[model samples]
Target chain A: MTKLTHRRLSPHILNRLIEGAPDESLALTDDHRRSLTARFRAVASNDHRRLDAWMVERAGLPYEPFRWSPASARRVVGNAALRRSLSEPTLTRGDAVALEVSDQLLRATSGYARPGSLASWLAQSSPSVVGLVSAEAANWATQLDEAAQELERPWSVAPSDAYYDVARARTTLRGRRDLIVPRGLTRVVLRVRAGAPGKSAGPGLRADLTIDALAEPTGLAASRVIGLWPEAGVVLSVDGTMEDLRAGARDLVRTAVAWQRHRLARAA
Target chain B: MTSLLDTTPVSVMDVLRGERDARPIANTTAASGLRAELEDGIFALLGPARRDAPLAIRASTLRSGTYAEDLTASLLAQVRGLLVTQALRLLSVGLEIDHAFDDALLAWRADVGSNELTRFVDQLESDERARLATDVTAHCVTLKRSLGPLSSRWLPRTSLRAYQRLAGGDVVLRDVIDLMVGTTTSDQASVALLDVTTSPLGEGAERVMRYHALVQTLRTSIVPLRTSMFSTAAGELWSANVDDELLSRAVGDVLETLRVMTVAP
Candidate 1:
């Protein structure tokens, strides 16, 4: 019995095993391949089964182990039969290629798969077993090997400038804005001086002025009807001198303002 | 005693805003009386000081028309605003403390896992684990409930305007009490040590310490004064010529008493 060379299976078959394929049909013809491609396109758009069948048929190889259903193909591709047929040199070379493809897939998908698993499966077969793998596959494998080596190099000596440029390109999409509110209450102060210094001694001598009037003048002069509350009431004692009294009134106004501001700020 | 004209008016706004420091000014009977009068005017005019105040001052006119009416309304409005603000402030404090205690209690229960003890007993045919779980769960529930009403009853019920006008406006004395009682950090070490020797009591001994801290903080914040005063009780109390310093002092005294009781060694 002729030993089936593992190299007979194409890279298209490897791609089919990794990417997955559609249902198997009995009739192995161009029309059958077309129908399978249509069915796979309905599901995933990229028909791995159609590609694999075309490669195998064009290479004029009998579909023996490769003709199984897609799920069974996944199992067989990873089996020991394929692993023994490939020489160590061929397996190692195939692994180098598979490693590149896996690395590319990972970079594209953001660390979604293990590199070792893909490399192990690809190393089980040779290019000759897979029959004339595409030039695109060979080129991708070489580029992937270079990328893997670049990644494996020491971070300290690695091309950090290139990485930084890539990172900068990613983050240049957007920025942010900030808003600030002013603090505390708005305030105004008024200083009052008695017209006649001694006239300060009498009760109800001057009427109470509204706060706004205190700030600015109005048409009507101050009214006795609006007499200050303290002026209307009788006093009990005279402990301090007139100057002291003026100073005390000033302090009280100051205290009121301070207290008002503190209260307002606390609320805010 | 002298009339308002006898005493010179100094603006309190500068002092309050920290623009000017308070001086040791003498308070003669006349000056004190004048000061009191000025305070009333200041309070009444607080609203007009706002940027969009309608009480426009005319440079030529000595009197502003409708100033008196506007001033009265403004004063009432200011008092109402103060009441509502204070009530909300107290409520917020109470809610925060209550939530903290609730969280601590939940953490304590989960840490012990007395709930799983019952399941262990059921599987083993021995009643020991079941009994322990039941006992621990009961103790935890008791401690949790001791924290008191999570929701405060002291929030203002009346309109904000009315609350400001009412004497002893919507301030709830109990809200302060709740805050003091709730925020107090119990002597955790002492409680744990005691629990080692004996089963933890429904109210751990450390609760008293927490109560003390709360009352002390509350008392320190309020200033004391000597006469009858108007204050927000729950936020609606407003009155003319009310002694605010006296009211603050009274609240302080009440908190002090509670602190003394809680801290009694």
Candidate 2:
């Protein structure tokens, strides 16, 4: 950790995570990853047929990959904008952050989002509309990230979002980490959400921890996962532990099973 | 670009930021305390808000929306205000406003997301649309004149949303700040909110400002340094520091708004 001369009793969330959070990786060994992987695979294998059926249907149908346009996709673009704002200068300048995010959306969604998609709306929209889209997308992240702008650098590094392909299953369990702070080999992941976090937030954090941990081949999972609901003004942080990973795996499997069963039943 | 008001000794922003002489500004802790109080007060008097149909409170819901009951003029005023706000955001972000109305309209439609609202807006007759466009351009000019080019140091954020579910999901308070400047550091409170409007300042306008302050406090624990509302139509700006008295008024306003919603059929 980069040491500061003096730290307050209760610093802001950024300071707490960067300066005070423990290294969760310290507790994990190769043995833990192997066990966690095996545990998930064992359960997932039981419902392989159902899982494959769901994956097949998922790819067969058309769907829009969520991305920001000038005016839509607040969460998707907001997180990215926040990370970019943390490192870049002059972001607070007229619509700079939003405009950059707009360009990013166009690049990310090209040939992916359907032609009539909102992500494609910016290309045909007027200058003011484009400005509006950029502003809306950048505003939430700016509000959250700018609050801690004075903190030292590298705290708001772009989070490495992961997609863990389920072992022996056709589905990818996606995990989102908004911001990450490094502490030696171990790291802490922060997720900035839009509104009041609900009861599902706990299971959501567990799932995030499990997916992020397993995505890495050799590295340990982040020491902590923080869920921030900017609208609600709340932060929830969960330590990465074996027990937490176990719960995360179980919830992921249970949720997949229930969802697959519902989808198959609907198709029938 | 220099502001139209640059000729004046003190600009509008200077006036808004001028009240720093007050000691002990509002911080996130006080805001948190108010949240708990507001939540407790709701359950104590009004009972819990029903999960199925909670009051989604907005600024327009104030004064029982008596003036906005399908009045075409009021609707035009609302749209005009939105366009002007959009114009300011666009200009702030470095977009040229050659056709202010059309540019803002495109962004506004995308943000609105309601098919009904967009459909109504898109279906306007050519003459009405032209007139509306002219009015919006004029308002945008006023906004540009008043706000000027805000320096990046202030960390200007546009259309900042304030949404919080209070009373354990019974009452949902939502508002939008046209422009927000400054933010809290680890030590001090520095956030300020500006609500841009088409109408002149009145009792209703002040109520909306108080409402914005309260919702913003709950949304971001950092109490704002000051909250101001500028009427693009009148070129008038009303600003006040966030203090215990203002927050107290906000809490009362929220409970009272919820109470009215609870009793209404």
Candidate 3:
């Protein structure tokens, strides 16, 4: 004759009962039965409200949501392929240049300030490629935060306790050494549906393509830049010298544009 | 069709009608039931007897009676009469001698019990019965002469010593007949009775035969059941080879699962 409440029969208790009880023993005592009836009514009411909320959200949806167009799809694909090649076990100077170009692209479109709950869900569900995507996203977000801080204080770039070592290096070994100076890296932010069709780069993709370029001791003083290209199929950071950098940048552009072409072909 | 005085004596007729002061038998129905029960018991004890033997006929005759002792005695006499009758009948049946012999034997056995006067007269003891013995011997000789041509091939083989032994009348013919019939029929019936008794253990002939056939058919059917899974393209992708042990284990698992599922709540 003990009274039972819905609160007492929590989800844990319910799960245990479902797992342990025989199929025929589903009957509940009078008080527990009454509580279940009331709980079901509350759930039904909440479901109705949730449906209405969804309808309102859909009504207020934007018409043109994407900032980046599919015009750069092929470029993104080429940059991604080059980046993969550079990160291989066997690395040459040429591979290093490609890596630098990839790194530059990765830094440029860095959007690390974004929330992580959605990405974490993707990581859990699609375990294969999530780790790399997450790393790229975090790097981009950090770069963006640093860029914002740099803009706030311009004098911070001068040789103080923070910039003195870098400055001394530049002056002491002036033209004798190929002193590599690490430039600001770009971060590319992209939103992708995991396990998408065809190439990795797609339209509606976003990422901070950071171009972290190392300054060579050449008269031109061109920084080694790498771009993070987060496209439909892959998140890539392309890096190289000025000449190689141009090639990597063009590759990213090609991937983004080809997305539309691929889409059209599929539709046809 | 002939008058009783011409065909058979007046005394024989009197004896047949029970007018000679013989005691009427008691509890004939109960006695018959007992005889049947005894026959059943005997058959339950022993197995089947050899065919065409005196033991088998004697057993059959004993099975047909109310009075056990009389039934036994009559059975022995009938068997002997059958042999004699068959020998006589064979002459006329010629080339179909075996068939004619068997038919004569059957007819003689059937009539043996009803011809009580002839049996009684044969059993009589009279030292001054020289005239009666001569008459009986004359009748026997006439019968033998009529049967001679039929038995000509085999009579030479039968010894006078065997005939004398049969006529000595010292053996309790009734007891001998009872034992022979009882042992032979009992032997035949024992096999069937044992089968019925052990039937609950599923060891009976019928059950054993059925199980044997079922096992063979099941063996054949299982091969096709396993092979059919590989006929489709999708099926080929998932094809797994099943050995006898694995198949048996799978079947056992399913049976165990069903047993658990069906347990009373």
Q: DockQ winner among the candidates?
A: 2
Clashing pairs in 2: A70-A133, A71-A133, A94-B92, A94-B93, A95-B93, B28-B221
DockQ of each: 0.00, 0.44, 0.00
Q: Order of all candidates by lDDT, from best down to worst?
A: 2, 3, 1
TM-score of each: 0.15, 0.79, 0.13
> In lDDT terms, how accurate is model 1?
0.23
Off by over 4 Å in 2: A1-68, A71-125, A147-154, A258-268, B1-11, B19-28, B47-52, B63-77, B112-114
Name the 10 consecutive residues with the lowest summed lDDT in model 3 chain B. Answer: B175-184
Best-fitting candidate, scored by lDDT:
2
Chain A accuracy as TM-score for every candidate: 0.14, 0.71, 0.20
| Model number with the top TM-score | 2
Candidate 2 structure quality by residue, lDDT tens digits, A67-132? 445544555566666666556664653344655556655764575655665555556566666666
iRMS values for every prediction: 39.7, 3.5, 55.4
Evaluate candidate 3 and give its CAPRI docking class based on DockQ: incorrect
By DockQ, the candidates rank as 2, 1, 3
Q: Model 2: share of native contacts present?
A: 0.63
Worst 10 residues of 2 chain A by lDDT: A1-10
Docking class of 2: acceptable
Candidate 2 lDDT for residue B191? 77
Scored against the true structure, residue A103 in model 2 reaches a CA lDDT of 66
- Return whichever of 2 and 3 wins on TM-score: 2
Q: Which 10-residue window of candidate 2 chain B scores lowest in summed lDDT?
A: B63-72
